[model samples]
Target chain A: MHISEGVLSGPVLVSGMILAAAGTTVGLKRLDYDKVPRAGILSAAFFVASLIHVPVGPSSVHLILNGIVGLLLGWGAFPALLVALILQALFFQFGGLTTLGVNTVIMAAPAIICYSLFGRAVHGATRKAFAAAFACGFLAVFFSALLAALSLIGTEEKFFKVSVLLLTAHLPVMIIEGIVTAFCVAFLKKVQPGMFARPGMTDPVRGEKGGGK
Target chain B: MTIMTRRMNRPKFRVARMRRVGPVGFVLLLSASLVLISGVPAALAHRVNVFAWVQGKRVHVQAAFSGGKKVRNGTVRVYDSKGALVTEGTTNVKGEFSFGLRHKEPLRVVVLAGAGHRGEWTLSREELSEEPETPASHSPGGASTDTSPVPGKSSPEAVLSREELRLAVEKALDRKLKPFYTLLADSLNRRPSVPEILGGIGYIIGLVGLATYLRYRKEGKEARPE
Candidate 1:
């Protein structure tokens, strides 16, 4: 969900940019050199995913996949999502450049939070991992929607109704993302189990401490 | 082959089989579900877009989503260059709204389609001007020598006063420019094509690659001994 330009006030935009800059700094620091390719791939996934519109009730919403990105890349989701948002702004004007910072924070903050919440649990056994991944996906969207609504509320008091509608509209997206993230997690577990390992650790070959906490 | 080969081959085969049956099949299934879900006729992604232009002494606006669905019953607000509210109203069923031009300065039109979706377009002073710099007298019908209406043979234009004739000319110019206005709206409302989507993805990859390269170089230097 992208917030278009001119909807936010000057103070909100400035503060958003400041917070986003700080997040990017920490995200880049946590982004190891070996993880760059993974981050890049996820960034591309995010870029493509947002274009695939899934029609819900009155309005349609697209895949964000930020939850998957967070589960896999941890703090790296910030820079990865920022890249995707920049491209969306430049090419499709999905969100304007002036509001890019706010949009980035709106989407990426929840992603980082998801990473902190379920990043480790996603490496557990099948059932546990699936549950955690589902929560990761579901809560990521829910929190991002909440943050988006909060940003709009900061801009104008009249946006209260619009904010509520936005949250309600995204409920289906939360469910869809939860299922998708679960499937993706299960797939990754089989193909490249090392992805779920904690950062700074060597790849866990089969039978070694494969299941992270 | 020994037992080692059999043991290794078993997991490899299972993994390969799982790959085909898992991620790939899941992707296909997801695509199929998306296709089926999107089959509903009312499926539309709502990205509000507003386009406005000056017509006569009024500013007309059209607001719609990306898929060309009208944003019915939305609020349309016009703000002057000073950031003051000029006028505000609701869009009609056709997602169209109009208001008399109250200020000489530039105006910004914002359409609120509810659900946190908003679109905006601005009308610059030059674009809003109804008359060109050249005097109307220099035009073909500028000189109105007839002071009296010819009875029983009067055309509507011939009976009008100078001001009414100018108003009529303005109306005619607006009619002539109707196509251009439509063209403007069409261009503004056009959705991103496939190439644009690919290009956007390419840009994301390029930026990520740059970041990766920089990080790699820095890490390489750090890993090396002086």
Candidate 2:
């Protein structure tokens, strides 16, 4: 879901940069040294994930995997995605270098939103956790599609039409992401329950089975 | 049995080592290997490319996604230097559109593939010169027919011969150079190659190292004050 170069206006691009900077600040503040390696791995995953295309929808549709990144990192999704998007723009012109801010916001905002919405529910091995993971995966892309369309507001396109078109085109991607996110969460919960950040100082290994509120 | 007892005596070291091989590192290694095995750099997705060049009186445009998928029925709008719509049409099944221009005056061609996927190329006035780079002057008489002329055609032999030779050279050059231009345009918006993919991952790792270094430096400075 990369928006190409020279499409957006000056104001939209500037505002996007400002918001992205603010988000990254918060993310970096919360992200401790212990978490930097995790962020890096997730960022690398994001860079590689966009290369795999599903070949569905009006245009090219690919797996973003931002939902999983968000579920793991929350606000940390901002800086993580920023790194990946920068590399994508530099190496592969999927998005413009100037529009990096806007593109980062488009991908990261939904991820942060999804994490806030479904991050807690999917913190365990419960079936409910898997269900929330699916929804998180599905909704993250849905919100990202909406944001991408919204970024075109200052341009020549009609907002309503573009939003509807983008949403419909990503319909299959939504389902696919949902399943992928669920699978990752289930696997992580079984293997490393400590991956998901808990609110209190709960033992990550034992908390997964009995920490459900 | 001695080694087993030694391992049992070093639970602290084992726990410390576990911290090093965290779940994130495991996932990274697993995913990196998966990518290496899949060889996904061959076919990238979504990135759109628009290439326009001048040929005879018409400026032709080709619009396609990075993975060689043509933008079928994509809306193509051509605007002149003054930002006025000069020619507008939909790309054909081949992702091609051409419009005759009365005057060069520089033109911008924008292609909307669909759903906010847009690509554009500007055609400079100099490119649309009177003398087209392609074989614009070639007659319908096929290349084979050039050598064996009609027995009774009412044309001068010397003038016809010079003209025929020029046309033949133009045709050959155009065929050879056209692919070069297409290659150039494709690179302007290309899919990720194997080297690029590997390099990008390497860059991410470098960034990670940089962040950790900065972090340690900051902590070290604070500890020195204490």
Candidate 3:
């Protein structure tokens, strides 16, 4: 979810930008040369996923898909998500330029967290991988929604009620993304086992030059 | 025998990789279904939309998410053209807000829905004025003559009557065409088209390609020295 311009305090905005800038630097430094294509493709997927709205009751919520990106790209999710968000802001105005840093941190930080918590498990036994994938998807949305609500705390009154509502609004989305990610992980496991290999691991033919996780 | 077994597994691996294409196909299928489901006439994403118009001495505003859901109890602030805060209030349960026009100049109305959703609308000076142009002869007497129109019944009273009639007509017309206006706004907020999605993807690919090329060149330079 995007925090529109003028909704955040000056301190919040500045801090968000600083955190985002630091995250992007680390992400770029860790970005494997070979995985650039994967990062780009996932960035595009993240961009388009926002347009897919799944109707819940009266209103509809779109897919963020940041969980899958983070699981696959690790720290690369930062740069990938940032690029996608900037394009979305430019093309569709989903989020304005002024709030871009805050929006990027809101969506991308959870992805990085999911990667740390569930990334390796996604490459384990079939059942364990499925469980981890589901958790990754669910937790990613859960945390992002929480961070979004937190961003509004400084600007609005009744912070708890608004935060709860924001989190509840995304409950269905969590389920949908969990199922989607589980299926994607299962498929990738069967087709491209190399994708699950640790970053910098050397293949007999490709050596250590191969890209990210 | 081991070589033959490895050869056999290679084909199987290739086949499995080919089937990996299934995930890409699944994503496309899911996107297609989403497009079909959300293609309904008056649905949009979560972004807020606001619209306002001058009706009589008050400005009427409606604020809602792009999905047509009302933004109830949200704060609505009004500012004059000179950037001075004119008035501030909250929307009713119906996502509708109205405030008396304090100044004849243009006005900006901003709706701040909690959780960082916001919508805004601006009304030009012409839209707020009852008459488009001033009467050339009455320029000097315009200010003092507004309230004492009974003394000069012919000029000021006629203008007042015309203003009243125009407001009545505009109100009726707004009510009659309310559905059309809502529909137009809903369509404007519809999900991005397939081409737009493709364009975004293209940009991402191009950006990644550039990054990859730069990385490759840097690595090449290092390897040449080695």
Candidate 4:
């Protein structure tokens, strides 16, 4: 998921960076200072969740909980994910420092979309928050993978092949991430029902906080 | 009768013939000689060998070239145990690169450079028997010889000398497998632990707990409406 330096072409990289910056700006517009600490906590959770490596075939893959992030943070997920990626590049070297902007956009864009579309649907209607979380988690990862696949399409003759490889490569990891997020959301619901039931737990829905269905 | 005899004596006529050869004949001869000469190893005579060690998280690699044209753009990759790419860097203007590794694990360090580079030594923590005696000594008497090789030491397969590590890495890149090498290097650099994962999970839980407590506390205060 960490797009190394020199993977994407220059024009694509630059364009992605521009879009990411715009998205982050839009996401940050309505954030209140009081919500800073909670946002920071969510970002940190997303960051560390990627560290747990599970063995697959001859290699190992880690969890990327971009879906959970979107479900919890809503619009604020974009900025939070962007910050987390930058921090990961700088401190952990998970990805290259030079390609930080591009990587941020690739990972965060789908998360924002998922939060906007699925966050409310899963949270407002479904009493089964875990199931909603599961769907969001799976779809967000799938979308992020799709966006990456689309980025390479038509540019390289091997795009289709690489896309298949990448999608298949992430399937197992995505399933694991879905399960983890479902359980995490269930735990959140039990311990702090307000965190989800009250809209104020997140930036976009801070006024109403969480609205239990 | 004399004039008739002179008119009958005509000069003998001669015809000249020209022959042309096709280009294929010339090209075949040239290509054959090239194919014959290609089998000789003399064309690749010069290479370098590199030996590297991580001393107190600092990489110290020694390079010795076996007499050849100078190679450029050498690279080094350091990996941790889990096959993640930790660090990738290029050599300096001096054809030497030293990296201060941030990871502490049994690392696999790959030094890649161009052709003519070959490595001959692997220096793990246990391999340091005694320092090879060198004539270039600063002290007149015997100086304290540091003999312990660094724990995480790996040399590239082809490098015969320490200097050729850069070329090997570059060659690996041209082969389209530098990412795998980078992963190997990262695993050599950082020794990631299960505790780290546990701690990460622990931290997330701790934060959620704190946030939930604070949210309830804030809600209670807001209900009173001072």
lDDT scores for all predictions?
0.76, 0.78, 0.76, 0.53
lDDT of 4: 0.53
Model 4 interface DockQ: 0.02
What digit string (tens of lDDT, one per residue) describes model 1 on residues B194-226? 898789767766766887788779888999975
Q: List the RMSD of every prediction in angstroms.
A: 5.7, 7.0, 5.8, 30.1
- Candidate 3 per-residue lDDT over residues B41-156, each given as its tens digit: 43444577888876545677888776566778889999887888889999888788887766678888898876787878888877877633334434436535654756645565
- After superposition, the stretches of candidate 1 with alpha carbons farther than 4 Å from their true spots are A158-160, A197-213, B1-12, B16-47, B102-105, B131-184, B215-226
- How many steric clashes between backbone atoms does each model show? 0, 0, 0, 49
TM-score of chain B of 4: 0.30
Candidate 1 on A1-213: residue-level lDDT in tens?
A: 788877788888988899888888988887766667677777877776776666654566777888988877777788888888888888777877888888889889998888778878887889999999999999999888888888887655756675677778888788888998888788778865766635444333333424532
lDDT: which is higher, 1 or 2? 2
- TM-score for each predicted model, relative to the true structure: 0.78, 0.79, 0.80, 0.49
- Flag regions of model 4 displaced more than 4 Å: A124-128, A153-156, A193-213, B1-187, B191-226
For candidate 4 chain A, the 10 contiguous residues with the lowest summed lDDT are: A191-200
**Candidate 3: which stretches are off by over 4 Å?**
A57-59, A197-213, B1-42, B82-85, B92-94, B131-195, B219-226
Of the true interface contacts, each candidate retains a share of 0.40, 0.43, 0.44, 0.02
Candidate 2: C-alpha RMSD to true structure equals: 7.0
Query: On residues B6-98, what C-alpha lDDT tens digit does candidate 2 reach at each position?
Result: 988798676556555558555865475446534533334556788998654567799888877778889999888899998899999978888
Docking quality category of candidate 1 according to DockQ thresholds? acceptable
**Model 4 agreement with the true structure over A68-115: per-residue lDDT tens digits:** 666666666677777777666554555556556666776787777766
On lDDT, the candidate that comes out on top is 2
